[model samples]
Target chain A: MIGEMILRNVFHRPVRTAISVIAVGVEVMLVILVVGLTSGLLHETAKRVEGVGADLMLQPPSASVFMAFSGAPMPIKIREKLEEMKYVRAVAPVLLQFNASGGLDIVYGIEQETFKAVSGGFVFHEGGELSAPNDILVDDWYAKAKQVKVGQTLRMLDNDFHVAGIVEHGKGARLFVPIQTLQELSGARDKASVFFIKLTRPEHTAAVADELRKVFPRYEIRPLKDFLSLMTSSNLPGLETFINSMIALAVSIGFLVIFLSMYTIIIERTREIGVLKSLGASKGFIVRALLSETAVICGIGIVLGIGMTFGMRAVLTRVFPTLTILVTVDWVLRATLIAVVGGLVGASYPAWLASRKDPIEALSYE
Target chain B: MQNAATILAPAIEGFLPGEWDVDLILKTDNLWKVYRSGKLEVSALRGVNFEVLPGEFVAVMGPSGCGKSSLLYVIGGLAQATRGHVLVDGNDMMALSDAARTKLRRHKVGFVFQRFNLLPTLDAYGNIAIAQHIHGNGFDPHRFEVVTSMLKLTDRLHHKPSELSGGEQQRVAIARAIINEPKILLADEPTGNLDTKNSEIVLGMLRQLNRDLGQTIVMITHNPEAAAYAGRVVHMRDGVIVDGVPED
Candidate 1:
């Protein structure tokens, strides 16, 4: 009955109801979009790092320090030294650098045969495998941003290289090059920037890191998961702060809009409220009726907002290609919980006003 | 002999005492209602003593600002009197908790507003059914038919308040009021919003409800013609009862 009454009243004032619904929907959509973009960035960055299947990365102490803000150089020989250990299954050497566009990029020096093992069987758009020493594989994002195609030669760090293939991975920007070619181009003798180590299994990875810290006291042996988290969080604090602030702002707006809408509705229907009151409706009943109206309005807005999120995903992707806005089940759950809380918060003020209305005063109001 | 006594009792005596006797359904002693706005305190009801009996139709008549509606609101438990005591169905309103007073108002007293305060969202039947529902009682559909038919609303059960005429809406309000079988029915100018035709229709139904169903009704009205329909009339001025004609 409360639902029916709310539905009827909602339609009775179509213009006001629509405005209120749109206001709520816009706020909800903003929150969903911001959260989706932020989490997508984090997930994509992690995916790119996970693509290598390296249990841990060994970098020069200062190399780990500047890895987030800017690329730093480590000796090219760290990979060879780590590979000699019996516990180390394989060591994929990598050199870190940045393009002229200021986008940080990884230059991996992967063995022709062993590159397949470290690539985690990732699909390449053009090339079947990493074969030529001077050929480079670039991610679609980097390739598109640079406007480079297969067989296009580009000079980096005084060495010219050919774009052999285009690679696509979840949300990560990467460019792969052969080990000898990266080593020769960078002009670093017997020195590798970073060592990507694949341990025997999950259990041996932690032990290997512990063992590496003891053996090579000068380098930082960071597990893939922890390293990426620290790097991303440290690198993107501004975006994270902005998203957090936006969430609070959106929720506040949702509460205010919903509350005012319900308040106006209750005030306009004073006679109806009195009738309900005089009909033996407890204060609890009155409060529930008003809140149910709020929930219904907000629920409709949220459903529309969710639909809008999906419909606009393509546009969002086009706007920021690096962002992987994957609408996972968890995100949907979070949005639902946030929306429900927002609806409840919005209804609280109006419910109080409704419960406090004197049936006589209300009956007399209109 | 019994039929003769029963007929004579109501015509001459104030009321017959029975299990459903209306006498003392509501009692107020020296009730006062003072409104304080900033520094000025105006008295709306100044020590008015009143009693409404069961199975009696009483109209409270007074000019504007004569405290007629204030007295009704006080007696109906909708407002708290500034001073003095109000007792409804043996419950002292001043002493009862807010929740208890709310319950007393809910289960015991029925209210009809001058505006025909029917829920606009509900149809006539829906409005009537809500009373029982709010009181946590299962709706007795049979009683719905009896009350609605008594008010001449049998044909307009499904019509919302906006769709119905003022008279029909007032009738639905009355049906909703009496659906719970409340001990007292308080109508504040139930015909105030109706035209002569609709007013007559509503007043006629209220009179019939009192005479046939033995329901107690207390109406606040300023119109002499509307007040004349009641079996007894009470006049108020400055929040005190100026005159009251006994039922005899």
Candidate 2:
């Protein structure tokens, strides 16, 4: 009966209830979207790094392990030294650059034969692999997004390059061109961004990385798996803090909205609370009623938030085909828990205030 | 009848140890209440002694601000007396903790307000059921139906308070007050907000419940006509009892 009263009370004032639900819903949506987007980015980065199929990555000591933002250049001489090592079978030097369009597109300059030897050969969706000096291979999603077809000329760094083929999704960077041509165009004659090293024996990866690290003390050399772990484990500067800040922002929004709404409700229902007290309602009863009402509202808002997340994800994917959004069950549960807890915390103060009101004074209140 | 163990066990075990005067179900010795605001003080009740026997219907009559309502509130354990003793069912209310007093109120006393005090969100049935819920006795469907039928609210149980007429709302309030079968029902101007016809209807229902069920009632009203339903009337003036005789 008390539960029914609580339900009715929530719906009794439709406008107030709607505002509270929408406010909580929007906060939950932001939590899921922001956290989900961050997770998607990490997942995609790891998959691409693994797809390179290299035993180790060697970069300048100051370069970031994150492939997309890695900018410090290493001497191309390092690739030759790595190939001369006993266990190293092949070494590919890559020049990485962020596109002018907000760094969403990654350009990789690679030697065709050495790249294919260090990493598995790409699977082309259309046309053949890299053959001409100005030929470039782009990922299928990026090709479609940028409308780059085979035989079409695409410009990068003030130079025109012919689209040679479209690689399968997640195969490589969004754009790939000849290393020498890119080096000349970018005015870096003997510099490469990073070196991908392949080992003859898979079990020798750790030993090879340790040896390379000692040989080039000014460079960073790590097994591919280790680098991926570092990226996902939040060891990258500002990533964990950024995600934590987003979560805090989302929870704050939910907390303030529920607090204000429930506070106003308690004020408006002062007489009703007095009546309940007069009818022998214990303080526990009043608190339970208020919290139950808040829980139901938060539950509804969470459901709406989850629905909105998937709907927004569908729309975003259609608009930006290359954008990946992973809505995992874990994230959904986390968002739901956050919203409910925020709501309960928000309503707690108001519930306590209502319970502590003097019955006679409240009853006489106009 | 409705599992006495569930309804009476807590009340019996937690009841305060005091002088057990079986005949006097409610008593107040020199009950005093003073209102304080900043540096000013106004006394609402002054050295008033009162008593109500079991199964008695007593009406307290007074003009506005005569402490009639304050006496009811103190006796009902809803307010504290400045320097006095209030005994309900032989337990000293002033000596009990707030939670214990709340429990005693739930198990022994019920209140009906002048405003009819029905939760607007709940229908008539829900409002009545909630009383039993708060009393910690759980719901007894048969007793609920019996009370609703006695109050002539059987057909109107599905309607919310807003949808009910003033008389019907007061009747529902009355049913809620007694749904737990409390030993005493404290009503403060229950018909103050009703029209003449509705006031008569509500007063009649109170009289019927008192007579048929042997329910102890203490009602506060200014109208002598409303007092006629009670077995005794106590008149008050300037926070003190002016007349102690019961009109036959």
List TM-scores for all candidates, in order: 0.84, 0.94
iRMSD per model? Answer: 1.9, 0.7
lDDT of 1 by residue, B1-248 (tens): 01111111122112222222234666687899998899999999999888777688999999999999888888877778889988776666776656666777788888888888777777888888878777666688898889988888899998998899988999998998998888889999999999999999899998998998888999999999999999999999888999894434
Per residue, candidate 2 scores C-alpha lDDT tens digits across A1-366 of 888899999999999998889878887888888877877877777678777888888888877777657665878987778888989999999988766843367788999999899888888899888888899998988877777799898877778889999898764577899998888877778889888888999899988878887899878787887755676627567878988898899899899999999999999999999998888788998999999999999998998889989999999888787787878898899999999999999999999999999999888878
Per-model lDDT: 0.75, 0.86
* Candidate 1 lDDT tens digits, A216-289: 99777788767556644345637768977988887877778887878787788776776676666778888887
Q: Write the per-residue lDDT of candidate 2 for residues B1-248, one digit (tens) a residue.
A: 01111112123578767654456778788878999999999999998878788898999999999999999998888888898898888788888888888888888999998889889999999999999888887999999988999999999999999999999999999999999998999999998999999999999999999999999999999999999999999999888888864322
Label model 2 with its docking quality class.
medium
Tell me which residue pairs clash in candidate 2: none
Steric collisions counted per model: 10, 0
True lDDT of residue A232, candidate 1 = 45
Candidate maximizing lDDT: 2
Query: What does the lDDT read for residue A137 in candidate 1?
Result: 77
lDDT of 2: 0.86
Q: Which stretches of candidate 1 lie over 4 Å from their true place?
A: A62-72, A87-90, A98-124, A127-136, A141-148, A151-164, A168-172, A176-193, A198-207, A223-242, A318-322, B1-22, B245-248
Query: Which runs of model 2 end up more than 4 angstroms from their true locations?
Result: A131-133, B1-12, B245-248
DockQ of 2: 0.77
